[model samples]
Target: MKRWYVWLGAAVSLVFLYFALRGLQLQQVWAGVRTANYWWLVPGVAVYFLAVWARTWRWHYLLRPVQRVSLRNLFPILVIGYMGNNVYPARAGEVIRAYVLKRRERVDMSPSLATIVVERIFDGVVMLFFVFVALPFTPLPEWMRRTVVLSSALFFGLLLAFFILAASPRQARAVYVWAVGRFVPEAWRPRVTAVLDRFMDGLGCLRSGRDVAMVFVTSVAIWLTETVKYWFVMHGFGFSVPFYVLMLMAAVVNLATTLPSSPGYVGTFDGPGIAILAAFGVQAALAASYTLVLHAALWFPITALGVYYMWHERVSWSDFGAAERARRSEPEVVGTEMRDARQREVR
Candidate 1:
C-alpha cells in the first residue's frame, strides 16, 4: 500500500512536470541554454563532485565508531543512492543506500538507517541556520516572511524532537512499541518488539560529544560546499548574486526536494529555485534559466555516474527495485531492533 502510494505520487509529479515544461516557450529556454558558459559548467560540476565526496565522508565518519568503512567503499554507494532518489520517489534512495551498505560492508541496515536519519536532522538544522543568517541580507518579500518563519519553526521543532529521542532511548522505544502495538498483529508482537528494541540501540552514537561535534562540522561543510556550488552556477550565468543569497537559495532548493515530486525533482525543484532567485532580485527569465542550469549541474552528472557505478557493481534497476521491495516487506521491527542493537554496541 505504501509503495503503491509512492508510485502514484511520483506519476502525478512527473505528469505535472511534463506539462509545466511544455508550457514554457522552447525558443526562450533555448536562448537561455545557449547563453550558458559551457566551460564554467565544468568547474561547477567539479565542485558538485567534491561536495558529494565530502558528504560521503561525513556519512562514513558518523558510521565510524560503530563500523569502520573506507570512503572508497562508501562514495560510490552514496552516488548510487542519490541516483536512486532522482529516479525513485518517496526518497527510497535512503533505504536503497542502507541496503547497499548492508550488503557491501556487513553493516546492519537499521542502525545505518538511524545514522542516516540523524544525518538528515543535522542537514536540516544546518540549512535552517543558513537560512536564518542569510535572511536579512536577501530582499525577501513581506509575504514570504511568514513562510520562512513557519518553516524554521517546524525545522527546529523536528531537531528538538531528534535530540530528545537521542538522549532518551527508553522513552523512544516505549513510543515505538506503542505505535507498533496499535496496528501489528498480537501474534507477532513479541518478534516486533524485539526488533524495535534493537533498532533503538542505534541511536546511541549521539551520546559522544566528539561524535556530535564531528557530525556538526561535517554537516556545515557539506552545506557550505553546496552553497559554493550554487554560487558558481550563478556566476557561470553572469549573475552577480551574493554568497549569502546563494546560501539561502541553496537552502530553499534543498527544502524543495523534500516535497513530493517526480524523478530528479523535476518541476518541484526548478520552480522553487526560480522563485527563490527572483526573491533575491533576479529577473524571472534569467532566474528560470539559472535554475535549469543549476539543476543540470547537480543532477545530470551524478545520475550518469550512478548508472555507471551501478553497472560496475552489477546491480540493475530491477535489482534495486527488488531490494527496495524486500526492505519494504520487512517488519518495521526488524529495522528498529537492528538499530537498537547497533546503538548499544556503539555506546
Candidate 2:
C-alpha cells in the first residue's frame, strides 16, 4: 500500500513538473541562474532558520500544557521531522519527530503528535491570512481565485470544528467513541477510547483563548520571517516583486506542497510557485529558474542541519525505520484530528 501511494505521488509529481518546465528556455533559465548574486542566499538561509526557530518557540508553547519540553530540546526534533519530511512521503517525518521525542524526552507519542496537528492547523490559518491579505494585489486566474477561496472556507471550517471539539472534550469523547464504535470491532473500542482520552488531553491548550492567540501570532511570525527569506531570494534574480506578493506565493506554494507529491515536494513546490510568479509577469523561464533555486534553498540547508543533528544525537536510518513502524501502531484517538494531517508547510 505504501509503495503504491509513493508511486502515485511520483506520477503526480511528474505532471506538475511538466507544467513547471514546459517552455524550452534553458538558455534564459541558465542566464538567470548564472548572473545572480549568490550571496543573497546567506541571509535567505539565516532568515529561514529564524522562522524555524520561531516555530520551535511556538511548539514549546503548545507542548507546555502537555509535558513542558524545552525549546532547546524540541528544536532538533523539529528539524529532524522536517528532514524526514523532505526525504519521505506523506510527511512521515512528522511521525518520526514524535517518535524521537518519545525516545529522547520520554514524552508520550500520541500527545506530542497532537501538538504537531495543532501546529499544522495554526499554520493553515496563518497562511490563509497571507493569501487573503495579498489577494487584491495579485490578479490570479478565475480558477486559481476560486480555488483559494474554497480552500479558505474548508480550512476555516476545519479549524472551527476542531476548536469546538477541543473546547468540549466530554462531547468530543462521546462523539469519538460513538462514531468509531460504529465501525471498529467490538473488542477494539476500549483501546481506541483510551487513546481518545490521551489525545484530548493533548489538546488541553485549546481550552484557552490566550494560548490559541499566541499560537496564531507565532505562526504569523514564522511565515513572515520565512517570507523575508523569499524576499531575499528574489534579490538574487533581481526581481523586485512586492513583499506581500511573495507572501502570497509563499502561502500558495507551501500550501500546495501539502498535497501528495514526490519526496522533497519536487513538482508540488515548484509548479504553483512558477505559475504564481508567471501570473505576476515574470517570464516562464525566469520563474522556473527562480522557483527551482528557491526549492533547493528550502530543501537543503535545514535538511543538512537536520542530518548534522541526527548524527550528533546518534539517530540512524534504523531509527527512521523504527519510527515508521511505530506510526502503524500509534493510536488515533479522534478520527482525523489525531489522524489526518492538521495540514502542512515550511514557508
Candidate 3:
C-alpha cells in the first residue's frame, strides 16, 4: 500500500517534469546553466538558512507553552525534519521531527505534532497572502487561478476554525468528542479522544490573540527571506523579474510542493515555479533553467547542514532510519502510550 503511494508520487512527478521541460530548448537551458555566475548563490544560500532560523524561532515560540527549548537545539531538529522530508516519502519528516523532539527534549509527540500542524497552517495562510497579492499582477492560467482561489479559501477557512477552537477549548473538546464518537470506531474513540485533548493542549499559546499575531508576522518575515533568496538566485540567471513576481513565484511554488511528489518535491516544486515565472513573461527555457537551479540550491545546502547537525548530535543513520520505521509502524496503542508518558512527565 505504501509502496503504491511512492510509485504514484513518482508517476505524478514524471508527468510534471514532462510538462515543465516540454517545449523548452535543453541547449538553451544548458547554456544558461553553464554561463551563469555562481557567486550569487552564496548569499542566496546564507539568507535561506536565516529563513530556516526564523522557522526555528517560530517553532520555539510555539513550543514555549509546552517546553522552552533553545534555538541552538531546535534549529537542528527542524533541519533534521526537513531532511526527512527531502529524503523520505509522504513527507514523513514531520513525524520524524516530532519523534526527535520527544527523544531529545522530552516533549510529547502529540503536542509536538500539534505545534507542527499549527506551523503548517500559519505558513499556508502566509503563502496564500503572497498568491492573492501577486494574482492581480500576473496573467495566470485559468487552472492556476482557480487553484489559488480554492487554496486561499481553504486555508482561510481552516484558520478561522482553528481560532474558534482555540477560543473555546472546552466546548470545542465536547464537539470534538461528539464528532469523533459519531465517526470513529467505538474501540478507538477512547484512545483517540485522549490523544486529541493533549494535542489541543499544545495549542495553549493560541489562546492568546497576541501570540497569533506574532506567529503571523514571523511567518510573513520568513517567507520574505525566502523570496529574497529567490531574487538573489534569479540574478545568477538574469531573470530580471521584479521582487513581487518572485514573491508570488515563491508563494505558488512552495504551496504547490505541498502536493504528493518524489522526495525533495522534484517536479512538483520545479514545474509550478517555472510555470509561474513563465506566466510573468519569462521565456520558457530561461524559466526552466532558473527554476531547476533554484531547486538544487534549495535542496543541497540545508540537507548538508542537516547531515552535519545530525553528526554533531550523534544521531546515526541507523537511528534516523529506525525512527522512520517507528513512525510508519507506530500503532494507536503506541501513540496513546507516548502521550500518556508525556502527560506523566508534565505532571
Candidate 4:
C-alpha cells in the first residue's frame, strides 16, 4: 500500500513536470546551457564530493557509541549507497548500505539504520534553518512562505520526537507495545514487540552529549557545503544570485526530496528547483536549464560512481533483493528481546 503511494506520487510529479516544461522555449534553455561556465562545474563537483565525505564522517560519529569505524572505510560505502538511491526507487540504496556495513564491517543494521535516521533529522533541521533565514531576502509568494513554515515545523517536530524517544527508551517501548497489542493478534504481539525493542536500541547513540554535539556540528557543516555546491552551480550558469538566496533554494530542493518520487527524484526535484529560482526572478528558461544542470551535478556523477562501485564490490542485484526479502521474513526478534527484558525487570 505504501509502495503504491510512492509510485503514484512519482507519476503525479512527472505529470506536473511535463506540463511545466511544455511551453518553454528549448532554444533559450539550450543557450543557457551553452553559455554556462564549465570551469565552475569542476569545482562544484569537487565540493559536492566533499559534502559526501563530511556526511560519511558524521555517520561515523553517530556510530561511535556502539562501535568505531573509520571514515576511510565508510566513504566508498556511502558513495555506493547514494548511487543505489539514484538507480533504484524507494531508496533501496539505504538498506543496501546498511547491509554492506553489516556484512563487511560487522556493524549491526539496527544501529546503522538509526544513524541514517539521525542523519535525516539533522539534514531536515539544517535545511529548514537555511530556508527560514533566506525567506526574507527572496521575493517568495505567500503560498510558498506558508509551505516553508509548515514544512519547517514538521521537521522540527520530528526532531523533538526523536529526542523524546531517546530520553526514555523503556517508556517508549511500553507505549509501543500497548499500541501494537491493540492492532496485532495476541500470538504475534510478542514477536512484534521484540523487533521494535531492537529498533529502539539504535536510538541509544543519541544519549551521549559529545556524540550529540558532534552530530549537530557535522550536520551544519554538511549543509553549508551543500549550499556552496548550489552557489557554484548558479555561478556556473552566469547567475549572480546572492549566497543566502542560493542556500535557501538548496534547502527547498533538499526538502522536496523527502516526498515520494521516482528514482533519482526526477520530476519532484526539478519542479522545486525551477520554481524557487523563478520566484527569485530568474527567467524561466534559465531556471529550467539551471535545474537540469544542478540535477546532473548532484545525481549523475554519484550514480555513475555507484554503478562502478557496485560492480567493483561484487554486489549483485540478487544480494540486494535477498536482503529485502530477509528483512520482510524475519520476525521482530530484536525489539521482542528488549521488551521481554523490560517486562522481567518490571515484574
Candidate 5:
C-alpha cells in the first residue's frame, strides 16, 4: 500500500506538471528565473523560519496536555518531521516526528499522533481562511472556489468530529461501536479501543474553548508569516500582486500540496501557484518562474536545517522505517494485557 501511494502521488504530480508547463515557453521561463534578484530570498527564507518556530510553539502548546515538552527541544523535532514530509510519501514524516517525540520526551505515540492530526486540521482551516479573505479582492477562478468549498466541508467536518470525540468520550465510544465495532474482531477490539482512548487524550486541548482559539490564532499567524515570504519572493521576480493575492496564492498552493504529489510537493504546489498568478493577469512564463523559485525557497533551507538537526539528534534515515514499525506496533504493545485477559476469559 505504501508503494502504491508513492506511485499514485508521482502520477498526480506528473498530471499537474503537464498543466503547469503546457503552452508556456520554456526559454522564457528560464530567462525570467535567470534575471530575478536573488537577494529578496534571504529575508523570505528568514521569515519562513520564524513561521517554523511558531509552528513548534503551536505543537508545544498542543502536546502540553499530554506532556510538557520545551519549545527548544521541540524545534529540531519539528524541523526533522517537516524534512521527512518533504522526502517521504504519505506524510510519513508525521509518524516519524511522533516517534522521535516518544524517543526524546517519553511521550506516548498515539496521543502525539493525535496532536499532530489536530495541527493538520487547524492548518487546513487557516489555509481556507486565507482563501476566503482574499476571495473578494482576488477574484479566483471557479475551480478554486469549488476546491475551497470542498476543503471547507472536509476540514470543518473533521473539526466537528474531533470536538465530539474529545468533548464526549462516552458518546464517541458509542458511535464508534455502532459504526466500526462489528468489523473489528473481538480479540482486537480492546486494543483498538485503548489506542483510540490514548489518541483522544491528545485532543484534550480542544475541550477548552480558549485553547482551541489559541490554536486557531497561532495557525493564522504561521500562515501569515509564510505569506510574507510569498510577498518577498514576488518582489524578486519583478512583477507584483497585492498582499491579499499572495495570501490567496499561498493558501491555494498549500492546499494543493494536500493532494497526492511527489516528495516536496513538486508539481502540486507549483501548478496551483502558477495558475493563481496567471489568473491574476501575470504572464504565464513569469508566473512559472516565480512559482518555481518560490517553491525552492520554501523547500530547501528548512529541509537542510532539518537534516542538520537529524544528525545532531543522532537520528538516521533508517529511523524513518523504525518509526513506521513503531507506529504499527503501538496497538500490540498497548493492548497486550487486555488481549491476554480476553483470552483467559475465553479459556
Candidate 6:
C-alpha cells in the first residue's frame, strides 16, 4: 500500500472516531462494557463462523465454471483472506486469498481475482437489500440516505457491467481488442489480452441466469446468517432492537466499512454501528460498548485462525506484500505461462 493511502485511511478512521466518541459518557460506556453478560457471545461466535462457512460454499459455487474446488479446501483460504482483510490495509487479504488459491489450486490469479470481485459486488448488493428492507421500519438520517443512494448506484452499475461482460464475452472481447490495439504497445498487447481472457473466465458463472440466481440466493443466505450473529451480540449487551433494525445496523455498518479506514475498519465500522443503535433509542454509551465488543468478536477469532492457517499453509507475512505487489504488476510471463496452464487444466 502507498504510504499516503495508508495515512489517508488512518485519517478517515480518526475523523470517524471523533464522531463515535465525542460525548461525555466514558463512565457509562465502561459500565456497559463491564456489566454485559458474556455468555451470549458463545452462540454469537458460533453463528458467525457458520456465516464464514456459508461464505466458503458461496465461493465454491462461484468458482465452479473456473475450477470445482471443494468446500473443505476453500474454508481455510477464506478464513485467511478475512484475516488478511483485518490486518492489512486496502483489503489486501482479497489478493492474498487469490495468491493462496493459485499456490494450492493452480488457478490463475487474474481469474481468481475476478471471482473475488464478483463476490464483493454480490455482497454489496445484499447489503443494499438489507438496507432497503429495513428502511420502512427505520428512518435513516439524510446523510445515510444519500450514502445508500450512492451505494445502490455503484453496486447495480457494476453488476450490470459484469453481467454484460459475462453474458456477451465476444462483444466484450471485441471492445477489449479495440482498446488494446489503440492503447497498448505492440510488445504488451498479447500479454494484456491473455490476462483479460482469464479474467473473463472468472465471470463465467454470471453468464447463466440460473447461476446468477443461485449466487444471489446464496448471497442473501450469507448476510442473513451474519445478521443472526449481530442479533446474538445485541442480547449480550442487554439492548433491544427489532430483528429488522439489527439488519439495518448490519447493512449500514458494513456499507460504512467500504469507505477508506484503517485496517479492521476501526472507525468506519463503529461509528455507523453506534449511530444506528443510538438513533433507534439505545443509549450512546451502551451502543458504543456493544459496537466495540461486536467488532472484537468479529475480528479476533477469525484473524487468529487465519494466522494458524497461514502457518499451516507455510505462507509467511512477506507473502502478503507479494500478493499486493502481484496485483499491481503481474509479470508479463504470467500472461503466456498461466494462460497455457489454465487451458490444460480446463481441458
If scored against the real structure, what TM-score would every candidate get?
0.86, 0.93, 0.92, 0.90, 0.95, 0.96
In the range 62-132, model 3's lDDT, one tens digit per residue, is: 99988999998899999998988888778878887888887899886777888998999899999988877
Q: 1 or 2, which is superior by lDDT?
A: 2
Off by over 4 Å in 2: 331-347
- lDDT score for candidate 5 against the true structure: 0.91
Candidate 2, residues 161-210, lDDT tens digits: the string is: 77897888888888898987898897667657766677677788888999
Model 4 pairs whose backbones collide: 194-335, 194-336, 195-332, 195-335, 195-336, 197-335, 198-334, 198-335
Give a tens-digit lDDT track for model 6, residues 1-347: 88998998999999999999998388998899899998889999999999899899989998999999999999999999999999987898999999999889988888999999999999999999999999998778888889899999999999999999998999999999899999999888878887898899999999899999998999999899889998988898887989998889889899888888899999999998999998999999999999999999999999999999999999999999888777656647666686688899999
Give residue 132's lDDT in candidate 1 (0 to 100).
84
Model 4: per-residue Cα lDDT over 47-122, one tens digit each: 9988899998888877776678999888878988898788677777888888787777977676677778888888
- Regarding TM-score, does 1 or 6 come out ahead? 6
Worst-scoring 10-residue span by lDDT in model 1 = 195-204
Q: What is the lDDT of residue 164 in candidate 3?
A: 84
All candidates: CA RMSD (Å): 4.4, 6.8, 3.0, 3.3, 2.5, 2.6
Global lDDT scores for all candidate models: 0.77, 0.85, 0.86, 0.79, 0.91, 0.91
Ranking by TM-score: 6, 5, 2, 3, 4, 1
Model 1: C-alpha RMSD to truth? 4.4
lDDT of 5 by residue, 217-276 (tens): 999999999999999989999998889988888888888888888999989999988998
Count steric clashes of candidate 6.
0
List ranges where model 5 is wrong by over 4 Å. Answer: 177-181, 337-347
Where is the poorest 10-residue window by lDDT in model 3?
326-335
TM-score of 6: 0.96
